[model samples]
Target chain A: MSLLWRNVFGQKTGDDSLAGFLGSIPLFAEMKPRDLRQLAALVHPRDYDDKETVFSEGDPGSGLYLIRNGRVKIFTRDSSGHEHEIAVLEAGDFFGETTLVSPAVRTASARTLEKSQLVGFFRADLLDCMEKNPRLALRLLFGLTRAMSERLHLADRELKRLHHALHELQAEGQD
Target chain B: MAESNGLTRGHVLLFFLVMTASIASGLAIFSSASRITELLHTATTGIVLPVLLALVLSFLLEPLVRLFERGPLTRTASIFLVFALVASGLYLAFSWLSPHWAEMWFSLRTDLPRYLGRGIALLKEAQARVQEIFPYIGGFDLPSRGRVLAERLFSHILAQTTGSALKIGGLMVLVPLFTFFFLRDGQKIVRASVGLVPNRYYEMAHDLAWLISRQLSQFVRGRITEAAIVGLVVGVGLSVTDIRYAPLLALFAGITNLVPYIGPIVGMIPGILIAMVDLGIGAQFWWIVVVYLLIAQVIVDNFILIPILISHVSNLHPLWVIIAIIMGGKLYGVLGMIIGVPVASILKIVIIEIRYYRQTFALPLGEFDS
Candidate 1:
């Protein structure tokens, strides 16, 4: 009877449980255990075969996915139609966080490098959570905002470095 | 170029075959609709209606359960608490309203024949006036025609009423049991069902299910709320005017109001008929009742309750709404009419999302990989 209850409610308590894994994610690190459990209930766990396309460039993105196991390659195509590998993400890495805040097209494609497990937390789920549990929704939105801010700062530094390199190249041409 | 031309021709042929198959299937289904409806109706009445009703109940009660869960209660505790509260509330409401309801029912039983006679006479008088205007038109036996029509209508209504009463009695036991299970294990059920989708479409399917469920929940909750408010307002308005059987008429109004566009007008008929019969057609009180019903059902309900509760829930075109209601009435009667709009809305969402997903994700990994 207890086993049935646990299975139905997903009340498994341990580091291996979905709520535990969700809690360990940096984005959800500050959330309460109860909130984490509630959020876990809304997520979908999926398995992908090797070389499976998760999403393609220009596809409408709807959610953030946390890698549970195996590796995923994020890449994009230039005008010349050459694939540029952006990052190879392993288990525990999360992507597609931007779509949580607004509807957007994926600027890059994601494909699995090996047999992989992923947990998706969609915008629809977030919106529903906002309606039912605004406090939990606020915590999630705050976490997403912080993560995006950090990424923006990193992008800013990279852009400054590229600008400096371009300046040096122009000076050399002038000489 | 030759190979590309062959590939294009093959694609065109495939498309043609698919379209032809689709059209043929659609025609077959349309032709066999009556048989399908019979099968569906039997299945629905036997077991499915209870489950469907329970599902709707669970959806309506979910927010309250969630609210309870926000406190110190576990989900199981919350569900039980909600059940207890609902049961108690129903008990109280029944106890308080039963006497008034009984009186109204008794009055309606006694007065129904007179009202019918008056209504038929009014119709006959109008027919005579029309014939007088058009002398070429021949007279028919109005009383016999009216009697036959009334008999048929009443018998049908009685059959439906008896069936519904039996279902409602069964529902007393089944609904709570089903609702409890649904509330307790709904997430697990959804997860297990979604788990069946192949990996290629898993995310899209998951998102679609969530989106659809949210829309359905919003729509069901909104419509019920709108109905309750409209019913209460009409009841109060009628009571203020001291109309006969106001509670019964209000209940009728509330139930009919679930069907969009045609419902409010249908709801107004019983009240107007009662007023006309009791107070005579030219009585000032009859006009007052007409004005009050118009205000309650039309001006207040359409302007206030619908915009507030249901406007954002469904954005169906008026033409589609009418067509859905008519088709629903044709297929499943009153239940069909009530559910038609939401079902149509769900189909619209499914088509749009499927098309969007297909457009966005049709490109194969091999195309890029190669």
Candidate 2:
């Protein structure tokens, strides 16, 4: 697995090849090849060893990091110093999406669960590209909007389930 | 473990060696750049000034380009449209204002000595009043000394400008070309510059560049807005008072307004000189103009435009600003002074980024490990 990871990262990355990777991610999926190539120009490939931090909780988030290969764990530590797992993100998954729109501190820490290759897309470059090429920017924005709405819907469902369970427990206790 | 310990020491030693060597070479390169700027200023003001002017002009006009982008125009088209608009506006303004400008220049040349004489007389009268109050300081010949100093300073600025006017005119033609390309392909230019950053530091470099660019844009936009308001107010006010060279003085005020704190004072000099010439000493109108200028400058610049328009864009301290202006002026003349604030802010950002990078990447050793 490590050798494969090394070989994948070691291969020469053409702009089109990078664009292909970005196209799989929903946030950039809607962009045409030409537009994707322009967007891909902003991505910086980074490698991490197993358990190495990508970013820490409360760090000022500056960009999104997409896992090109291997897995990453997103977690937070509570006051008692116990870690709560948020999500185990894999290849094709991108985190820190919130920073693309605005600069805000990270709510959770990201660490490589195994040796990984990631690509960073900075907020600065994203905003710059959007300004220069608004047509492409619109497409990317539409994709991001869809992704966000889906998340919101999922969250709403979770809230409804939790509320339903609370009502059931209350009724039983009252009886 | 011993091998790792030796390697760490070797790394530390190598770091210090590289740091010292880089600093020394950096200073050497800086001096060479300063020398080249001086040479370019003297030999090819046409080339240098156009590029410099275009840079500043692009910064000022970026918002217009962005505005047109919202209206379904491509970036290049928007840039061209903005340039065309500016060109027509300038031509119209020049046609109307040219005659007045020429007449003002003629009057200034012919009446300059008379103005200087009156200024000297006014100074003498003030000196007499001061000496009467404090007789021990009576021997000070401030009036003649001040006249000589003012004459020298005025002539120096005039000489510098006149010497470069022909070259500057030629340069102005090229400014639109430079500005057009800058507004159109500025992002490509910036993105290409990312190649200069090493892989490990690429993200930080890209982020810093954007951060600086945004801050500078805000600063330049705010300054231009402030300058326009102040210039209009000062011009109209002075013209209303029948002051000579109202437009020219107003233009000076607007340009110098880019400099902080001392800028308004420097800008007020020509207006005050005109007042001294037109109304003479002890004249109620002269005092009125002086009072009006003081009130206008204080009220408009300090009380209004700065707070409302230019609200801490660079976030530079007053002391650092003064120092930066001085250093910039010494290095690159007027242009340096104008850009000092933005440059200083960029340096500040670079330092902050370095600190952040260090904190993030530095070895996280336990207290016992070190």
| Clash list (residue pairs), candidate 1 | none
**For model 2 chain B, the run of ten residues with the poorest summed lDDT:** B361-370
> What is candidate 2's DockQ?
0.19
Clashes (N, CA, C under 3 Å) per candidate: 0, 0
User: Where is model 2 more than 4 Å wrong at Cα?
Assistant: A1-21, A28-53, A68-90, A98-103, A107-117, A125-142, A148-175, B1-52, B154-162, B192-208, B280-295, B313-325, B333-370
User: Per-residue alpha-carbon lDDT of model 1 for B1-370, expressed as tens digits?
Assistant: 5666567777989989999999999999897997898888787765665677788899899999999987789889999999999999999999998998878776776677777888888888887888889867756777669867876776676577768788789888898999999999987798799889876556667777776776677777888888888888778777766468878888888888887777778887878878777766565465546554666766887778878777453667789989999897787677778778767876776666566556765534446542
**Per-model TM against the reference:** 0.82, 0.72
Candidate with the greatest DockQ versus the true structure = 1
Chain A TM-score vs. truth, each candidate: 0.88, 0.86
* lDDT of model 2 at position A127: 82
Query: What is candidate 2's CA lDDT for residue B185?
Result: 82
Which pairs of residues have clashing backbones in candidate 2? none
